[model samples]
Target: MVAPLRVGIAGLGTVGAAVVRLIEEQARTLSARSGRGIRVVAVTARSKAKKRTLDLRGIDWVKSPLALANNPRIDCFVELMGGSGEPALSAIEAALKNGKSVVTANKALIAKHGLRLARAAEKHGGALNFEAAVGAAIPVIKTLREGLAGTGVNRVYGILNGTCNYILTRMEQEGLSFAECLKDAQRLGYAEANPSFDVDGHDTAQKLAILASLAFGTKVAQSAVYVEGISSIAPEDLRAADELGYRVKLLGVAVRTPKGIEQRVHPTMVPKSSSIAQVMGVTNAVTIDGEGIPAITLVGPGAGGAATASAVVADIADVARGIRAKPFGRPVDRLRDTKKAPMERHEGGYYIRLMARDLPGTVAKIATRLAKEKISLESVVQRHPEGVDATDAAKKASPVPVILITYATSEDAIHRALEAVQRDKVISGRPQVIRIEKN
Candidate 1:
């Protein structure tokens, strides 16, 4: 009979408890697949006194995360604690240094200290798997790190955040405002009270940093990602996107360019027919663009205990099967450093929404400014107020919403033209700009 793989888990939150339950429920299948039985030997959490749904009758309650990580009895250390620092980081470091395979779902820590942890794992001869970090149950990390090892990946992008995707989906489907959708998300527990991390794009940025490293074999650096939030998105923008046969989504995009590997997270305009556009609700999706192959897209539930724990257990199974791949697909030394890509140099089509003055010459002035910067327009629409004709609306001195879809242009050129238009007082309020990402 093969020996069982003993597991030590830190932080018995929703994910941790579900992981325990999954291992118990899928014992026979796991044993068959891994060639050994998997067991939860010990666990730790913020509050042991706090009642949990899972029955830990046979499990040892370790004093702390560090203790559980260093326990010699446990062969695999599973970390479900959500933080970029603290006992989580030190515990993971200790586990890897002890030559024990480690599994975690903490994107923040990976983004901040991934290379360092990977280096430690390399030197200690242990596996560091974070399949649940990017997209829960999506298998994106494994796809990028192992399955595509022989292929050349040109670009990898995805809707990695459920909170943002939920908010955006509601806005697009119901024609609701961003604020309204966010409030509903919070009430439904899809978002936190603050919601800045997800809404402001930092959460997506962290996940993107990890994906970029795996896809490009570059050092994972969260600071190198250019981030823009979804809070500025409104219902009007979604309507405009529908009119132009596109959809607005917050996407984390990592692509290779002449300058370097560019990683960014922002509100992007994708064609309505694209696979990414069809992904809605709290679901997540990732698209991998490899050399000489069709684009591969993986989609699934991105959060919740069941989805996340399913991935954590899969990582543990890999450990039981004696499968150990490099932490970032490439050796630590071979991973190149990632320099932050300047947003100003980003070249792509743009969706610009300007509240232009309805007076004569206003539209002419805007066109002249764009032309001066060598920017060409693909389409232009002046949305007059309901029940108001364009000439009549101008006579009423109402501000018209001019939506312009521009051909491929540099970010610097678009900003220059918009700035000139603002200075000329031809438009009111700040202009809304969304980058067009072609499928």
Candidate 2:
């Protein structure tokens, strides 16, 4: 009889515990699928005495993560300890050095040191699976790396962060302000006390970097992504989007362009009829545009112990089946270096909201500035006080909102025109700008 694949896991957090429980509950089905039994032979965590409901009766408790990684008895090393550096890095390297397959859900580490780790896995001839790193249980990594290996990917974009999506969804549906929604997200445990990582767009940037590499054969570079968070999005913008047949979403988009791959994360205005716009709340979705195949979108729970662990165990099962594909879809040496795409050259339609001064020539001045930058308006709407006439409102000099939808234009031109208008002092506060995504 073939021996069961022995597993050692580091970090007994929610995901690690779920992984153990899942393996135990699905042992029979796993054996049938993988053609061998799977066992959790050893485990380690920072605090072993921490009371957990787990049944570790026969499992060996290792002293530290590095020791568990180096444990010769276990055939696969699972690293749930998150971080871009230190114990997780060294331990993963040791596991790969020992020719033991490694599985992790650490997106930060993958974005930071993926190439180096991939090199180690390649040299040692062991699999380094991180399907949980991008979208939990979505199976996007396999779709890009293996399923679409024959097709050239033109674009891969998605709503990658759950916290941001939840916040935006509430803002659009309930007309809640960003700050108000953020506080509720914290109360509901969807956001961290220090929620800057998710709200400031860096979390989405890290995930986009990984997806961009997989789709384009470019080396993972978190620095290459242009990030803009949803914090600047306003309730008024969401209302305007509803009226204009669009929905505002925090999207991470990586598309192949004439200049190269353009990876960006920001509050995008997508058509209301589009598939991505329909996804709401904490759910996540990814859309891949390839050469000939119809656009494929995978949607599921982006994060959570059970959702994430499903992907983790799926990767472990691949190890049991002796499937060892290169870590980032291709050999590390074959992956090309990724560089940050210049945002100034970005071309797209824009939704601009300006608080224009209710004075004669104010409209003329704004139009002239846009004309100077060669930006043509597709549509424009001006709003006055509910009960006030235009003449009365203009006499009061109260600033009125003037919303402009522009045709395809470069980012630099929009900035230049807005700067000239700002200096002209015809508008109040900063202008609210959102890029439009067509389908």
Off by over 4 Å in 2: none
Cα error of candidate 2 at position 327, Å: 0.9
Worst 10-residue lDDT window, candidate 1: 389-398
For model 2 the local lDDT of residue 49 reads: 89
**TM-score, per-candidate, Cα-based:** 0.99, 0.99
lDDT of 1 by residue, 228-333 (tens): 9999998999999998999999999999999999999999999999999999999999999999999999999999999999999999999999998998998999
TM-score attained by model 2: 0.99
lDDT of 1 at 368: 98
RMSD of 1: 0.8
Q: What tens-digit string does per-residue lDDT give for candidate 2 at 1-439?
A: 8899999999999999999999999999999999999999999999988999999999999999899989999999999989999899999999999999999999999999999999999999889999999989889999999999899999999999999999999999999999999999999999999999999999989999999999999999999999999989999999999999999999999999999999999999999998999999999999999998888989999999999999999999999999999888888888888878899999999999999999999988998999999999998888996888999989989999999999999999999999999999999999999999987
